[model samples]
Target: MHIELDLNQNDLEALLHHCQSFTPASGDSREDGRLADALQALTEALLEANASQ
Candidate 1:
């Protein structure tokens, strides 16, 4: 299944900020790495969404 989100520019920006500033607890390098990858994908999505408007 697919998902959809309806977020305004400010909401998207705030979400991006939170994702960029997130830091998982120490000793969880695997989860931290996954978060980093997700962040990268989210950032790209944010840019693409903005560009489409």
Candidate 2:
């Protein structure tokens, strides 16, 4: 799924850089942990989408 990001220039740049530098940490929980950590951004996106409705 594609989610459009709503970030300011500096924040977006940082995010882009972070993704570029991101290498997965080892082991099973790593993926889920990352997703859990990322839920804030996803939640924000959902809120934005809902607000626009």
Backbone collisions counted per model:
0, 0
Q: For model 2, how does the per-residue alpha-carbon lDDT over 1-53 read when each residue is reduced to its tens digit?
A: 68676666567556656654555565768785786567555555655564675
Please give the distance, in angstroms, between residue 46's alpha carbon in candidate 2 and its true position after superposition.
18
Q: Give the residue spans of candidate 2 off by over 4 A.
A: 28-53
Model 2, position 32, has a per-residue lDDT of: 56
State the lDDT of candidate 1 residue by residue for 1-44, as single tens digits.
Answer: 34467999899889989877887665789988887887887877
RMSD over all Cα atoms, model 1: 1.9
Candidate 1 clash pair list: none
For candidate 2, the TM-score is 0.42
Q: In model 1, what is the error at residue 12, expressed in angstroms?
A: 1.0
